[model samples]
Target: MIWFYERRGEHLRCEIRQQLEGDQFALVVTMPDGSERVELFEDSRILNVRSVELEKLLRSKGWDGPFARDI
Candidate 1:
């Protein structure tokens, strides 16, 4: 799954996908500057926790989304 957020015309992207090599999940974040950050999770519970935390953080910082696509 993927989500996008924007503020002042800059975009932030988040993607969740399963890794091909193992039973792990990846939460990838793409910053507005084009840099990337990755977090690996062993289970869905923690992944959901972190995902929501990031969403709240971005919203508090004045970004608007979890849009289904880039806007």
Candidate 2:
């Protein structure tokens, strides 16, 4: 799954997918500046929790989404 947030004409991306190397999942965040951060999780539950937390954090910081697609 993927989500996008926007602020001041910049975009932030968040994507979640299963990793090929193990029974793990990845939470990949692409910052507006173009740097990327990858986080691994043992299961979907934890990944989902973290995803929600991230969305809330970004919203509090004045970003605009959880958007299903880039705007």
Candidate 3:
């Protein structure tokens, strides 16, 4: 329920909330319209996802990656 992006044009605020599913991290995307979308990443898809690699992954999906939330 945190603001991930500022409202701009057609893009509303987006958020990346993490959920604990088994031993993996479930990244839940909360869209501007209050809709939720979950992205599942296989081990192969994230086994090497670190720093720059992870940033590229998120950027590929139109995300700005994780950032500090403003109070």
Candidate 4:
């Protein structure tokens, strides 16, 4: 299971995890950088989100793409 969150003045945080509720999965949250808030979402919402969507979300949240790529 994976959950994601964005907070003021911080990088994106994602949680990758696995759990079993009698064969179900545990909720996971991955954040390389600590955040002020973590948003909990529905299980259904975690379904089939692509990397492109992530990049778009990051951009929408003011994540500037790559650094010094052309340098």
Candidate with best lDDT = 1
Cα lDDT tens digits, model 4, 24-46, are 33333344454333333335345
List candidate 1 stretches off by more than 4 Å.
Answer: none
Report the lDDT tens digits of candidate 1 across residue range 12-48.
9999999998889999999988999999999989999
Candidate 3 lDDT at 58 equals 51
**After superposition, candidate 4 runs with Cα above 4 Å error:** 1-9, 22-46, 50-54, 64-71
Candidate 3: Cα lDDT at 4:
53
Total backbone collisions for each predicted model? 0, 0, 0, 4
Each model's lDDT = 0.94, 0.92, 0.48, 0.43
lDDT of 2 by residue, 1-71 (tens): 88899999999999998989889999999999899999999978988899989989999999998789736
RMSD values, in order shown: 1.6, 1.6, 5.2, 7.2
Best of the two (1, 3) by TM-score: 1
Model 3 regions lying over 4 Å from their true place: 1-3, 7-21, 42-67
Candidate 3 lDDT over 7-69, as tens digits, reads 333333433334456544444556667787665544524633433464455567676534556
Error of 1 at 50 (Å): 0.7
lDDT of candidate 2 at residue 50, scale 0 to 100: 93
30: Cα error in model 1, Å: 0.5
Candidate 2 overall lDDT versus native: 0.92
* Cα TM-score of candidate 4: 0.33
